[model samples]
Target: MTRPAATAFPTPDDLFENAPCGYLVLSEDGTIRMVNGTFCRWLSCARAELVGKRIAARLSVSSRIAYETHFMPLLRLGGASHEISFDFLDAGGGAFPASVSALFCPAGEQESSIRLTVFPAVQRRRYERGLLEAREASEVARHSELETGKLREQFVAVLGHDLRNPLAAVSAGIRALSREATTERGARVLVLMEGSVQRMFGLIENILDFARARLGGGIVLTQCITDQLPAILSQVVDELRATNPDRVIDASFDLRTPVECDPSRIAQLVSNLLGNAISHGAADRPVRLSAVSTASGDLTVIVTNEGPTIPPDAMDRLFEPFVRGASSGYSEGLGLGLHIASEIAKAHDAVLDVTSEDSVTSFRLRLSAVRAS
Candidate 1:
C-alpha cells in the first residue's frame, strides 16, 4: 500500500485570519487591542490603523449610544452577551446591520478584555421592511373599497328618485284608457298592464328604501296617537287580497287601545309580511294576521303561514338586505321587503322576531303604544 499523506491542520493564527465572520478583541476601555484579517477587511482598513482606535469610532451614532448604554453594561455583569444588534459605518461612510455576540474575560494579572463576533443581517432587515409595506398596501385597498361602495349606493338612490315621475305618468295614462269603451280581450290586456305597472312600482320603492337606509337615513316616521290603526291595517290586507286573489288571508283585530305610530309605515310593514306569506305559504292553508293592544300600552301584531320550515343556517341572515329564502318557489321581488320591515320596526323601537317549525313560520312585532312625551 502507498504511504498515506500527512493530514494538515490549520494553526490558530491561520484559522483566525481566514474566518468567515468578523472577530475583534477590545480592552475594558473599548479600545481595539487586536482584530482578525476578516474584521479589518470589513472596515476597509489595515490592522495597524484600527489596533489603537476606539471601537465606537467604527459605529454609527445610534449604535455608538446603544453600545455604551446597553451592550457594555450587560457584558460586564453577565460575562457574556449574545445577539446584540448594531449598525457599523464602513470606510465609504455607508452603514450595514450586524448581529454581535461578546464574551468578557476578567482581569487576573493582566487587564480585562472582551472577545466579539459579528454576522451581517442585511437580508433579515430587508424582509421586515417588505412586510411593513405590504400591510400598509392592504389597509389602503380596504379603505378604497368602502368609499366605492358608498358612492354606488348613492347613485341608486338618485336613479330611483328620477324614475318616479315617468312611472306616475304611465300609470295615469293607463287609468284614462281603462275608462274608455273596449272589447273583452282589450279589457283583459289593460288589467295585465295594470298589474305589471304595480309590480314595477313595488320594486322601485324597495330600491329607494334600501338606498336610504344604507346611506344613514333610517326609516323616517311621523308618529302620532291614533285609534285608526285597525283601519290602516285593514286597507293593506284588502289591497293584497285583490292582487293575490288565489290566496286566502285571514285577518282579525282586537286593538282596543289607541296606539302611537306612523300609520303609513305600519301599513307598509303589514303589506310586506302578508305578501311574503302569500308567496311562500302552503297553497291550500290560510295565511293569518292578528293585531292586539293591551291596557298597559303595549301592542302586538303577528302574521303566520304554513310552509316548509326555514333552514337553521338561514335564520341569522333572513333580515339582511337582498337575502331571500332558498325554499321559495316565487322569485318576484328584490328580497328587500323583510329588511325594510325590520328597519321600520327599529325606527319605532319595536321588536320583530321570526320562528319556523313544524311546517309553520311566523313573524311577530311588539311595541309600546304610549304616546311620545
Candidate 2:
C-alpha cells in the first residue's frame, strides 16, 4: 500500500472565529484570553468586553455555582472536562441553555491555558417544549371528540323516542277526524292533514336512519328473496304523486328477474329520489322514473328531472350529509335525503350516481342481483 499524502487542514485563524460552535481560549485561572466571533455573537457582546474578563462572571447564577464548585476543581485535577451543561446570560439579560467542553494545555512549564467549545441549545429546548405541547393538545382533542360522540348518541335516542309518541298521537287524531268528516271541504282538509303527516313521518325516519348510520356501523338491510321491486318502486311513486298531484311523475318498469334485496330499503331509496326531484325539478316538466333489469343480473333504477343544472363543484359533495345543492332553486328539509339514499344504496351493494347537464339532472342506482352466499 502506498503511504497517504498529508491532508491540508484549515488554519487556526480560519477555524477560530468562524467555527460552527462558539470557541474560547482562557488563562489557567479561567480569565478569557481570546474569544471567537461565534462566541462573542452568542453572548451578544464585543470581543474586547470579554477577553480580559473571567468567563465565570458571564454565566447564569446556577451555572456559575456549578462551574465554581464542580467544573473548576475537576479541570484542575484532571486537566479536562467534557460535555458539561450550563446556562449563559444573553444580551437581553435572559439565560439560554448551552453545553461546553474544555481542554487544558500546559505551555513550557508555565501556567496552563484552556480551550473551550460552547454549543447553544436554544433550538433544542424549544423543539422539546413544542413536542410536549403537541402531545397535550392531541390528548385534549381526542377527549373532546369522545365526549361529543357520546352526547350525539344520547340526543338521537331521546329525540327518536320522544318525537314518535306525539307523531303517532297526531296520526290517530287525523284518522278519527277523517272518519267523522262528511263535507267535501272537510275531506280536503283531511287529505291535506294526511299528506302533512306522511311527510313528517318520512322526515322522522330519515333522522333516525341518519342517527343510526352516524353512531353505529351504517344502515342495516334485511335482504330476502322477492320479485316485488317494481311494485315497491311504483308504490313509492304513487305515494309521492298523491302528495303532489300537480307535478307529473311518469314511471316505466321492465323487470324479468326475481331479486334478492331489502324491499323496504328499495322503496325508501326511490321515495327519497322522487321527493328530491319533486322539490327541485322544474314544476312544469314531468319527472321520469325508470327501472330495468339487465341480462347480466343487475337491476338499475333511474330518476330524471328537467331543472337548472347542478354546479360541477357541488356534484362532488352532493351525497355528503347535510349538504344541499346550490342551484336546486329551492331550500328544504335537513339536506339528508340524498345522504340517506346513498347509505341505503351501499347496504344493498349498489352504486348511486348523479349527472347534470343542459338543465337536466338524473340520479341512477345500479344493484347486483347475484344471490348472496
Candidate 3:
C-alpha cells in the first residue's frame, strides 16, 4: 500500500482571517484592536483602516446609542452578551442590520478585550416590515367597505321615499276614474290597473321597510292586546285573493284569545307569506292558511302550499334580504317578502320557521299570547 499523505490542517491565522461572519476584538476603552477579513469586507474597508478606529465610529446613530447604553453595560456585568441588534454603517454610508454577540475577557496581566461576532439580519428586518404594512392595509380596506355599505343603504332609503309621491298620484287617478261610469270593458281595465297599483304599493313598502331596518331603526311596533287578529288576517287573505282571482286560497281561524302584538305589522307579514305561496306554489293546488290560538295564550299561524321542495342549500339563507328561491320561476318581487316577514316576527318576539319535504313547503309563525286584562 502507498504511504498516506500527511493531513494538512488549517492554521489558526487562516481560520481567523477567513471566518464566515464578521469578527472584531475591541479594547475595554472601545477602540478596535483587531478585525478579520470578513468584517473589513462587510464595511468595504481595509482591515488596517478599521483596526485603530473606535467601534462606535462604524455604527449608525441609533446603534451607537444602543451599544453605549445597553450592550456595553450588560457585557461588563455578565462577561458575555448574545443576539443584540445593531445597524452597522459601511464606507459608502449605507446601513445594514446585524445580530451581534460578544465575550468579555478580563485582563490579569494582558490587556482586556472584547471579542464580537456579527451575523447579517437584513432578511428578518424586511420580513417584519412587510407584516406591519400588510396589517395596516387590511384595516384600511375594512373601514372603506363599511363606509360603502352605509352609503348604498342610504341611497336605497332616499329612492324609496322619493318614489311614494308619484305612486300616490297614480293611485289617486285610478280611484277618480273608478268613481265615474264606464263600459264593462273599461271597468275590467280599471280593475286591472287598481291591482297593478296595489302590487307597486306593496313593493315600495317592502323597500322602505328594508332600508329602515338596515339603517338601525329596526322594525318599529305599536303593540296592543286585541281580539281582532282573526279579522285582520282574514282581510289579508281577501286582498291576496282579489289580486290573484284564479288562484285558490283556503283560510281557517280559531283565535279565541286576544294577543298583544302589532296588528298592522302582523297583517303585512301574513300577506307576504300568503303572496309568496300563491306565486311559488303549484297553480292547480290550493294554498292553505291556518291561525290557531291555544288556551295557554299562545298564537300559531301556518301557511302551507303544494310545490317543489326547496333545495337543501337554500334553507340556511332563506331569510336573508334579497335572496330568492332558486326553483321558483315567478320573479315578480324583489325577494324581500320573507326577510321583512322574519323581521316582523322578531319585532313581535315570535319565531318564524320553514320546512319543505315531499313536494310541500310550509312556513310557521308562533307568538306567545298576552290576554286582555
Q: What is the TM-score of each candidate against the true structure?
A: 0.73, 0.72, 0.77
* Candidate 1 stretches greater than 4 Å from native: 1-127, 183-185, 370-373
lDDT of 3: 0.89
Measured on C-alpha atoms, candidate 2 has an lDDT of: 0.85
* C-alpha RMSD of each candidate structure in angstroms: 6.3, 9.1, 6.0
Which candidate tops TM-score? Answer: 3
For model 1, residues 54-127, the per-residue Cα lDDT tens digits are 99998999999999999999999999999988898887888878889999999989989999998887887788
Model 2 agreement with the true structure over 26-145: per-residue lDDT tens digits: 998889998888777777887788889999888999999999999988888898899898888867778868889998897777777999999988888789789999999999999999
| Model 1: per-residue Cα lDDT at residue 22 | 83
lDDT per residue as tens, model 3, 1-373: 1222333775777677767788899999899998887777777887777898999998999999999999999999999999999998888889978999999999979989999998889998899889999999999998998899789888988998998899899989988998999999998888888888888888888888998999899998998888999889988898888779899999999999887789999899999999889888999999999998888768899999999888888889989999976544786888999999999998887999999999999999999864323
Tell me which of candidates 1 and 2 scores higher on lDDT: 1
Cα RMSD (Å) between model 3 and the true structure?
Answer: 6.0
Model 3 misplaced stretches (Cα beyond 4 Å): 1-86, 98-121, 369-373
> TM-score rank, highest first?
3, 1, 2
Model 1 residue 303 lDDT score: 96
**In candidate 2, how many clashes are counted?**
0
lDDT of each: 0.86, 0.85, 0.89
